[model samples]
Target: MSERKPVVLVTAADLAPEALALLGGYEIVYAGKTPSDDDIVSLCGQHDPAAIIVRYGKVGAAAMAAAPSLRVISKHGSGTDTIDKTAAAARGIAVRAAAGANAAAVAEHALALMLACAKSVPLLDARMRAGHWDKAVHKSLELHGRTVGLVGLGAIGLRFARMADAMGMNVLGFDPYAKELPSFVQRADLDTLWKQADVISLHCPLTEENRNLLDAKTLARCKRGVIVVNTARGGLIDEAALLEAVRGGQVRAAGLDSFAVEPMLAGHPFQKESGFILSPHIGGVTSDAYVNMGLAAARNVRGVIEAR
Candidate 1:
């Protein structure tokens, strides 16, 4: 008789077969989109999963408490905002994040957004396609020889800094907890970065202390016509203040991947608003990143499960 495989609950619809195969003897159950807290609690209680893999979904206190067999909570990507770490820790359950698994994909997306905003790609494309040639009035910001300020010095931030340096842009970074930095990247204080950088790219996590780090006052400190880019989290910027700054011409433009509210409505104000380039939080959803994140998540689950 063969030994029974342990049960693992996966909130996402699917993961790559290559990643699932790594678990060997784990019976993975796919539960697509738990819309409510009740559903989350029900699933954890019913499945009694040895491990829980979270992709884009959230796992909270109720879910953690309901599952006595839950040993680990593995995040498919880097951020841990959706998971209740305190609850997991209190129950002696391990919570692991797949940090750096999608660094390249996210860094590239931030760079892409910055370039598009600076060049006014969306605006120009729209105007030209509508049979209105406004080349005479169109102006684009030159990235070469510009100063770029990075808010965080993590894997994604470092990758973006290197890419900017290659394009002859000066890179300045500010991270209070950063230990070391590359020679190509100069260290700067928050205030200095605010006053000097022509482009400010945010790559920090959303914490209580740093929420709305880019508020009206901080935005006021920036040089006129400074471009803002955020691929990290939604709460980092005060959207209302950003819109006002853009309207007043204090800010040149903004590139946003995440929002304070997810799944922005069909007719959201930003859709018709000028000076803002937006995406549906797809900064780290590349095919390569999916594989890396899935495999890393699986490894975290298996490692924790095997420890006992």
Candidate 2:
């Protein structure tokens, strides 16, 4: 009888073919799209996977406990906030992330959001479709010579900063952990950045200390008509406060990719607000990023499991 190959579970319905080829020695099990926590737990219990390549669902203590043989949890993308790192550490399960794998893709998306907000692209498109051309009265904000403040200076943030700099915009950054930044990026405190910036983009992770970082108080401090862009996590901003700011014209526009809730439900208030631009969290959904992230995740999984 042939020995059974170790199981490798993927949280998504599919993976890039190249990535799958890299893990050809293992038995791959997919948990399907839009997997719930219970679905992950159930899959873990059934497969006893040696490693999990996280792509969709949250992996908590219960799911970790279900798979006694689990040795590693590799994130398919940069953010690992969905994984319970503390729990994984307690069980000696290593957690890894494919850092920078989707940097270009996400950074580009952030820039696109920023441009969309500044130009009111969606609103104008809708107007054009409705046979109304307000070219004489409509004015678009020019990005040149403007100051752009970025909350994070990681791979994605840095990439965005470069793009903004190329567009003749001054870049202010606010990441304490980042060091020896490029000459184009001037380090600034959050307060100073908020007060001076014409455009503010968030690329930081969501943490307890920074949750709702852009709440009513902070929003009040920003320059009126400042363009806001967030390609990072959603919990960083207070949705209600942002909505109010938009309604009152305290915020000129906001372009958001991620939401506090995944698959932002139908009839969400943002849907009706013309001041808001929304994307379905597809910042890193490009074909190139998919392969890059998958390969990175596969290697991380192999690095842990193959070593044992």
Candidate 2 lDDT tens digits, 1-308: 99899899999999999999999999999999889999999999999999999999899999999999999999999999999999999999999999999999999999999999999899999999999999899999999999999999999999999999999999999998998999999999999999999999999988999999999999999999999999999999999999999999999999999999988999899999999999999999999999999999999999998895
Q: What are the Cα lDDT values of the candidates?
A: 0.90, 0.96
**Top candidate (TM-score):** 2
Tell me the deviation in Å of residue 196 in model 2: 0.7
Best by the lDDT measure: 2
The alpha-carbon deviation from the true structure for residue 264 of candidate 1, after best TM-score superposition, in angstroms, is: 1.6
lDDT of 1 by residue, 1-308 (tens): 98667778888778878788898789888777534556667888888889988875678989988899999999988888888888888999999989999999999999999999899999899898999988788779899999999999999999999999998999999998888899989999999999999999999888989999999999999999999999999999998999999999999999999998886878877787779999999899999999999999999998898976
Off by over 4 Å in 1: 1-4, 33-35
Provide backbone clash counts, one per model.
0, 0
Shift of residue 88 alpha carbon in model 1, Å? 1.2
- Model 2 clash pairs? none
Model 1 lDDT, full chain set: 0.90
Question: How high a TM-score does candidate 1 get?
Answer: 0.96
Model 1 misses residue 205 by how many Å? Answer: 1.2
